[model samples]
Target: MSSSAAPILLLALAGFLIGGAYSTWKTLRWLSISLGACAVLAAAGAILWLR
Candidate 1:
């Protein structure tokens, strides 16, 4: 993978995780929170990777 591609992939993964969290919020609060945390981590990773 290219260096630029890594951050892009991480951001995409973050978007997917955010969507999963939102969808699971009604019936699975714990899972949603977990997903949200993961999404935040992924986003942070992407930002850090870009720097």
Candidate 2:
């Protein structure tokens, strides 16, 4: 569970960034956050499969 927590925390942080970007109307920031979320999900999936 500890091992899984890091990527989940990252995903949550990226989600917050996305929300903040949306509020500020920053397109690049939103895009970066979207990518960050995707990366986090991928990493989490990989970790789950590996485990």
Candidate 3:
């Protein structure tokens, strides 16, 4: 894997983990929060990749 991709992947992973924790506490809204986190991570990664 390219070094540049590594940090983005790590950001995604961190977002996922944080989402998991967030969803766990607020069960009713878990999916939205988790998916939102993933989306945000992807967007951030894309922006960084473009730079």
Candidate 4:
């Protein structure tokens, strides 16, 4: 885990969570789906960072 990567990883995770929540609340089903997908990608990136 390089120091440089930490911020980006954290940002991605945060964005994913925030976007997912907002999309879900906004009642836009398609956007919610997209946001969920982003969340998955963010999680994968986090896992890769840990490795």
Ranking by lDDT: 1, 4, 3, 2
C-alpha positional error of residue 42 in candidate 3 after TM-score superposition, expressed in Å:
15
The clash number for model 2 is: 0
Count residue pairs with overlapping backbones in model 3.
0
TM-score of each: 0.98, 0.47, 0.48, 0.57
Clash number for every model? 0, 0, 0, 0
What is the per-residue lDDT of model 1 for residues 1-51, given as tens digits with 9 covering 90 to 100? 999999999999999999999999999999999999999999999999999
Give the Å shift of residue 43 in candidate 1: 0.2
Local accuracy of candidate 3 as per-residue lDDT tens digits, 1-51: 997787677677667766665666566576766666776777677567757
Q: After superposition, how far is residue 15 of candidate 2 from its true place, in Å?
A: 18
lDDT of each: 1.00, 0.62, 0.68, 0.72
**lDDT tens readout by residue for model 4, 1-51:** 887688587667868676676758667777777777777777777667677
In candidate 2, which residue pairs get closer than 3 Å at backbone N, Cα or C atoms, i.e. clash?
none
lDDT leader: 1
Off by over 4 Å in 2: 1-27
After superposition, candidate 1 runs with Cα above 4 Å error: none
Model 3 clashing residue pairs (backbone): none
Give residue 3's lDDT in candidate 4 (0 to 100). 71
